[model samples]
Target: MKIAVIGTGYVGLVSGTCFSEFGHTVTCVDKDAGKIERLHQGIMPIYEPGLDVMVERNTEAGRLFFTTDLKEAMEGAEAVFIAVGTPSRRGDGHADLQYVFAAVEELADYISDYTVIVTKSTVPVGTGAEIIKRLEGKLDEHLYSVASNPEFLREGAAIEDFMRPDRVVVGIDSDRAKAVMSELYRPLFLNETPVVFTNRETSELIKYAANAFLATKISFINEMADMCEKVGADVQQVSKGIGLDNRIGGKFLHAGPGFGGSCFPKDTRAIVHSADDYEVPMKIIRSVIEVNEERKLAMADKVIKACGGSVEGKRIAVLGLTFKPNTDDMRESPSLDIIPALQKAGAEIHAFDPKGMEEAKHMLEDVSFHDEPYSTMEDADATVIITEWNQFRALDFGRMKDLMKSPVLVDLRNIYGKADMTSNGFDYTGIGR
Candidate 1:
């Protein structure tokens, strides 16, 4: 099978490379000449574990290719995957489908034969039908089939998620489109990976519904963490108790600053906007959004209170800037809100993350970024852990104590226990302890 993946961002790059790894010929197309040239030189634009190696191997094997020309990429391709970005629109929370529509309109001129045009981007419901309407006047209905195949890859573990996804959801109205999609994902069938075939709107809703539910779990637990702190109850034990029930699984129950990533914040907002257009109420998700925003801002206050009610003229050390560990993505990270608020309250910020500092530098201001963990804590009044990166899991507490002026630890992720910090002669503050 030959596949043409438009937009070589995270979704397009990872999906195209993995499809080639499965023995299909894939050409990833992008408008950025610099990115395409870098890919040719074995340089990856985004950071994903094991992605560079897979791309190099497939490129060497002549199974993977990158180019700026859509016509060239679509040459002899049976499946053209539109994996473009559908970010939330400013002021209106609706998905800005300009990029998706532009890609479809541009590629229409190059479609020389019957092809499966699949949307691999996370789009709102009815987008597939809209694509069909967009193409009605430009091309014959028999010449192309529009389908929705939303991606479900996590940022850090995208390659593994792509190769070993729990299930594949595809929306198609024709047997021809289904046959092409099945052939494209036939490798996963060997692992008994379930494939859910449904109508286009249902398939689109599935992606939004999954993310909204996970976001609800996060907001629910964070709210519970707030109550736990008020009652001096341990939220960890509470999470465990409810999680042990077969009905309530314990995946997104870890209480932290808030949920923020490329998917959750954007998808939740877009879905709410879509629901409003249809006059459907999304009260729970609306509250989830409001609570998450408040949670991030409140973390700054948490640190301030830990510092004896004031952070004025104080130096605070922060560990982790990305939304989570093992990815360089800084989109919607809690640290984005927390650090700025602390700075506004007259705290000087010193921060470090294993992979996020470079990207974080662009999004953050007036903060000193360090190369290593302990260096970030040097001469700090209080140390806060915003994201629970693995290195911060096992820290040299003795060295940390020696470096800082005051031994105040605010474990927002609750990675350390109160007894452990107290034994080390430090003031410890944790979320819902």
Candidate 2:
């Protein structure tokens, strides 16, 4: 299959490259000339594990192509995927559809043959209809069918998720479009990844529902974590107890500072807003949003209290900065809250991450960046672990103690056992324990 993935953002790039790895010839389009140039030079704009190697191999094999030409890229493409972003609109919480619409307009003008125009971005229900309406006039109506095939790729593990998805949701009514989509994902079908065939509206709803459910789990655990703090009970134990039940499995139940990334925050808010417009307010989801926001701020207070009360003149070494490990994405991360609050409390902050430093530098201001963990902890009064990177676990505790002015560790991620740290002559704190 010759595929054109428009908009070389996270979704587009990953989708295009992975499609090439799927034995399809793929062309990735981006309006940004500089980004295109960098791609041509084998330079990646974003950090994702195992992506660079695959992109390099595919590009060298001429299976993957990157360009700024929209019409030229779409020329003979059997399927064109609109993987553009639908970020939250200003003030309203509705997904801003400007980018997706703009891509559709250009794609409509360029289709020379039968093409399945798939929406791989997370979008609101009825967006497929809106797209068909907008493109039907200029588009070759007989040759193109609008399909919603929402992507469920997580940032840090996107390549793995894309290559081995649990399910593929295809939204369409036309048998022709369904057949083509099935063929496009035939390899996955062979591998037992179910192709969930459904209508466009239902598929869109699934994306929102999946994200909202995941957000609910995180928020639920976060609230429980707070209660555990009040009653001197460990939320980790509580989660383990409930997780043992088959009804409530143990995924996404780990309590953390808060949930933040490219997807959950925006998707949850947009779903809530969608429910609101229909006069069906999701009260539980609304509380999830509020509780998540407050949780971020509360983590700052947790850090303050962990350091023997006052943050004044304290040097805090933050051990991790990314939302989660294995990627450089710093968007909406809990570190966003923990850092600023620490700074406002008159604490000098030093931070280090294996991969997130470049991105985090712009997001977090007035913070000193260190080359290594031991280096970051040098002379710092306390250490706080924000993201659970592999290197942060099983670290040299004795070396950490030697470097830090005070041997206090606030492990927000629960990476280390309290007993181990206590016996090692350090004060260690975790979310619930």
Candidate 3:
């Protein structure tokens, strides 16, 4: 199969590369000539665990290519995926569809034959219908078929999610479109991967609904962690007890600062705004949003209280700045809120992450960033674990104690136990411990 993926951002780049790994010829189109040049030089714009190697292998095999010209990439392509950004609008919280629509308009002019125009971007429901309407006078009806094929890739584990996804959801209004999409994903058929075939609206809504539900899980567990702290119970055992239930298998149940990333925050807000447009209310999702925002802000106070009721004139060491480990995305990270609030309260911030420091430098101001973890903790009053990166899991406790002015630890992700820290001769605070 020949595929052209528009917009070589995270979704488009990973999806296009993986499609090539599936033995399909894929051309990833981006308007940025600099990004395309970087791809040609084997330089990736974003970091994923194994993306660079896969892209290099596929390019060497003549299965993948990158170009800035849509017409050149779309030449003889059977499917063109619109995998552009659909970020949240500034004031309305609705999905900013200008990029998606612009991609559609650009690719519509190059459709010379029967082609499957699939929306691989996370978009609101009814977007597929709008694409069809947008193409009414631009092309012949038989020249193209609009379908919805939303992506469900996680940031750190995108390649694994794409190749071994739990299931694949595709929306089609015609058999011709379904056949093309099925052929495109024929490799997955060997593993008997379940593929959900539904209408366009349902397929689009599935992406948002899945993200919103996961956000709800995070918010629910954070609330449980708060109550556990008040009642002097352990939230980890509480999570384990409920997770053992067959119906409520545990994922995203760990208590943390809050949920922050590209997908959860933006998708939840976009869905809520979409529901409101239809006069439908998403009360639970709205609460989840509110809870997540409040949780990020409250973490600052938690750190302040951990430092003897005041962080004024103190140098606080923070480990982890990205939303989660294995990715260098600093969008809406809890550290963005926590560090700034601490600075406002007259504390000097020192932070370190395995990969997020370079990006974090742009987002955070007046914070001392170190290359390594222990250096950030040097002479600090207290250490706070915001993102649970693997390196922070097993730290040199003796070194941390030696370097810190006072041995105080606030384990927000519950990666360290209260008893262990206390035994190590340090004051420790964990979420709902």
Candidate 4:
């Protein structure tokens, strides 16, 4: 199978590479000449576990290629995936679809034969109909089928999710598009992966709804976290008590410094805005957005409270800056909100992360960044765990205490509980402990 993947961003690159690994001839196209050149020299624009190895293996076997030419990549391909970024628009909070439409217009001009244009980017509902309307006169309308095949890959675990998705959604208005899309994903279908074939609008709505629901879950848990703190109830135990139900799984229930990443913040806002435009109010989603924003800002205040209600002239060590871990994406990370708040309260911040400091360097200003955990805690007044990275789980507690000026710990992630750290000679505080 020959496939053209437009836009070599996170989704496009990983999806295209995985497709090539599955024995498809794939050409990943991007408008950025420098990014294409970097790929030509076996360089990757973003970091994901095992992606570089997979890309190298596919490239060596001639299964995957990178190019800047849209026409050249689309030639003889059965399907073209539009996986461009759909960022949040200013003031309106709608999904900015400029890149997706640009790809469609280019496809209209150069695509010579029947091709399935699948929107792998998460777009608002009715976007498929809009794409079809855009390509009405520019191409053989009968030859192309605009599809809504939204991706649900997490940033850190994208390749695994793509290759072995639990279910694949195919939005099709006709049998021709369904067949093409089905044939295109025949590999996954062979694995008995359930492929739900639905209307275009449903598929688009599924993407937004899933993200919005997950954001709501995070917000609900966050609110619970605060109450747990006030009532002297452990949130971790609270999460487990509720998560035992088969209906409510244990995923995303872990309390932390709110949900902040590229997807949750923007998708929640976009969906809320879309609901507003339709005159159907989603009060829960709007609250989730507000709750998450407040959670990030207030998290630093919790750390200050742990440090005797004032961070004035105090050195605070922060571990982990990426929203979660395993990916260097710094978009809307909790550290961005928490760090600035701490600085304003007169706390001198020292930060450390395994893979996020390069990007975090520009996001945070006037904060000392160290390479290792021990160094970050050196002469620190207090240490705060922001992101629940694995390395921070089992730390040299004695060493951490030794290096800190005040051996105090405020764990926003609840990775370390109160009793254990207190026993270790460090005055410890955790969210909802």
- Each candidate's clash count: 0, 0, 0, 0
Instruction: List ranges where model 3 is wrong by over 4 Å.
Output: none
List candidate 2 segments past 4 Å from native. none
How far out, in Å, is residue 72 in model 3? 0.5
Error of 1 at 89 (Å): 0.4
TM-score of each: 0.99, 0.98, 0.99, 0.98
Worst 10 residues of 1 by lDDT: 243-252
Question: Scored by Cα lDDT, where does model 2 land?
Answer: 0.91
* lDDT against the true structure, each candidate: 0.95, 0.91, 0.94, 0.91
Give per-residue CA lDDT, model 1, range 298-337, as digits (tens). Answer: 9999999999999999999999999998889999999999
> Which 10-residue window of candidate 4 scores lowest in summed lDDT?
106-115
Report the C-alpha displacement of residue 193, candidate 4, in angstroms.
1.0
Ranking by lDDT: 1, 3, 2, 4
Q: Which ten residues in a row have the lowest lDDT in candidate 3?
A: 244-253
Query: Whole-model lDDT for model 4 versus the true structure?
Result: 0.91
Residue 380's C-alpha lDDT in candidate 1? 95
**What value does the lDDT take at residue 298 in candidate 4?**
86
